[model samples]
Target: MTTYFLDRGGRMTLPGNKFHLRVDGAGGRVAIDVTHRDHQGLSSGRRDRATVSRITQRTIIAAVPGDGAPVFRDGARVALFIESDDEHGSEPLTVEVVQQDVGATFRAELARLTPVGNRIELSVRAPDQLSPRALAAFRTAHELLGARTRPHAVADEIDIAIDTTASMAARLTDGSIPALADLIAGVSRAAGCDLRDVRLLGPLADSIAAEPLGTLADRVAAVVGETGVGIGRSTGVAESGNGDDVVLVVTDAPPVERLDTGPGVRHLVLSEEPIAADAPAQTGIVPAHLTATAVTAPTVPDQDAATLRHLVRGLLAALAARA
Candidate 1:
């Protein structure tokens, strides 16, 4: 059987088979475009569009169609087959999913993919905000996509803020808070920032206020331990981000929508993960953004530096303009 498949399981496509893909935000899921085009003179016999299914040699005789005919979901396991003219026992043509390769997808989207230190660290806020089913999905995905990574180091006295609202710590493991705190501490050390200099603003004011920088091994631990309240109400942290050197916002997107930043506060938003849907952004707060392989990429596939840069570009530009 003549078959072609897109490696990486992250992207699926059919090239010579005439199935072009467009990853668009149609509903709330990643939408794939499947256009059927006729290539004249390629074959004398009529090209009938047969069912798309994955079949093993053992079960070739009685394989059922895999999924939806017209609309196919991303990362789905399926195949396309054109009925062969041969008098064989079963249809001979079988094709596999050709989604883009993970590396190819990254290379196309990123102008440059700098190596991030091994590990992808993320702390979820407002666990209460997500439903049980949604949280489970997030956990599965999170487990798959582990700690942040990059070989580089930072030593600047930049500050980071996390919104640890109700049950947000639930997103991570049992003792993740301490581990996350330690990771931030390592990052702060790389940036050469004292624990006190690395301000950590969060909803738990009482907890943070109770901890002192001297008591912690590093600035990250100090901030993570301390508690502060409100998005715009941090006592020392200016909403406009005035004196703050560098600010990173670790929270889900929506509630932080109206978050204020400073004139020069280059910001990094570690969102809880934008709604996982190809659907248009339904929230009035977030305008629709289409991520296609054709245009400049919205998020680099696997590159952290480029991806982070893309995420904060607009915010940084605006703040820089004011600065």
Candidate 2:
């Protein structure tokens, strides 16, 4: 009697072919279409008079179908497609059935489906595309801010403000800022969070707002010199709802003065330096190592402590002896 859970568009790989299970979501009113792989014809369940519980948020409870349960067996893989009332369709998420204990096998497999699971998958597939530091920063944020504050289905509307001050040129040149933005946007897509807009903060001027995240980096770089570090001013002017909105400011230097970024807005600062104590009590800083440049060598994955020590010693000695 092991239960499986999945949000909209979530994919899972499970064990076993012969199984009696109830698939449920959308208050048991959703269309459940199950297809077997390798030409195995699996029966699609019926909808008439099925006992369905209320669908709440992203949580899906199983619907008990009396004598209407579909039989799934003799297939190496099964594809489940669930469509809601709004007619939102997703590609079938295939579940590979392997010969193993269901409970034990699922426990190991489901551990990977953390809040930051998308970031983990991206790291494995394309490590070079983004910095490890950015990946680590976002993972930490998910733990501190996302996993705690955000709901599974209806997450808060998050806005991002990037510091484009003259001091940021080195980070801009190294592609650190761009990579950080990419990771933030990426995680939002992977995890069910809403990214409202990205703002470019410049000195003594208005913040430049951009959306559609596709051309964010190029757009920012084209006018990086014109932007300023008006942390206080930008924070003051940021339009946010009653604490339902989250403002994440990625900057090296945060203002010491208290900020008033509207009522009930949860503000967070990501930087290498600690935020000033005078800042608003609601504002907190999450330490992020964003100093890596584009030319920096990528850290080898799964290195033990000794290998890391050797690498660090070599880099330090080279730095100390540099001409």
Candidate 3:
């Protein structure tokens, strides 16, 4: 397989079928033109059809068929366009042509790009908003989670807001909140965000606490109790973010007006209930126990913990999709 990386206005042509691809980068997207012409013998006429495909930084993979064929034939080429959102247009994607499925290959390549940092410091707010099971799970898996990575199109920073209301106390107690925090932080480093914070959005008030990832659970749990149940009134956080931030709010409560993060911030809600009408995107927090059958593994004895790890694997992918 041949791999090619194109900068702005770079062109490449396949040797056999005269499959030509021209790429242009600008404004956090890559624009590509694929042209195939018949140049053999009497068929030396230029097909001259200009097929343009625009790929945003969020989606780095796109394929254009050569010679209008389902499969690559002689003199036919397929183009895969990859681009990053950097200002200088750095990190151009690798385009390769192979006989197997390109989509599967792309997915495999993305999974290999882990985060840059292996350690993430712990920052928590309203420790009472966290739970025992979540805390335990986080502590057990903190190192593994902190070593994770995210996909392309990631923001510069990632912030997670956990709803500490009475209604969500059950979810918190089950270890979902802490698991979610680990999930986000694990991928933050790879997504180009070195800083990650978790804020406990309670009903009454908010507080700040910091510790190392391994011992954070004990600290968070001991501050309140064995559980995050009935912490207090449902209050929200007052964190300000800009366009370079990806703020993920984990809440079941629909409309907590005070939860307004800020304008120009890309917000994603991880909730089972319907969020505000203006919210850009929302993803449900799937109950791991209910889906235990789907999360089967021979080595993992702890089903809940295994399921939590499974969820962590998809956190960055989901964020990339929403982003």
What RMSD does each model have against the real structure?
A: 19.9, 15.4, 15.0
The whole-model lDDT of each prediction reads 0.28, 0.35, 0.37
Q: Stretches of candidate 2 above 4 Å error?
A: 1-155, 164-175, 203-215, 225-235, 263-288, 293-323
Q: How high is each candidate's TM-score? A: 0.28, 0.42, 0.41
Tens digit of per-residue lDDT, candidate 1, span 129-239 = 222222222222222222223211221234445445443344222333333333333333222233333344444443232123223323333444444234343444524
* lDDT over C-alpha atoms for residue 114 of model 3: 14
In candidate 3, what are the lDDT values of residues 1-323, reduced to their tens digit? 33554332233322221123332222122223221111011112123222212211121122222233222222322333322222343333334322122220111111101112321111111112223333333233333333445214545455666566676766666655554553444344323243355566664333334324434444444433443545554433534445545556666654545445453233344454544555544455564432342222323357566665555444554444222
lDDT of 1: 0.28
Query: What lDDT is obtained when candidate 3 is compared to the true structure?
Result: 0.37
Give the candidate number with the greatest TM-score: 2
Q: Which of the two candidates, 2 or 3, achieves a greater TM-score against the reference?
A: 2
Q: Rank the candidates by TM-score, best first.
A: 2, 3, 1
Clashes of each: 44, 4, 9
Deviation of model 3 at 119, angstroms? 27
Specify the poorest-scoring 10-residue window by lDDT in model 1. Answer: 104-113
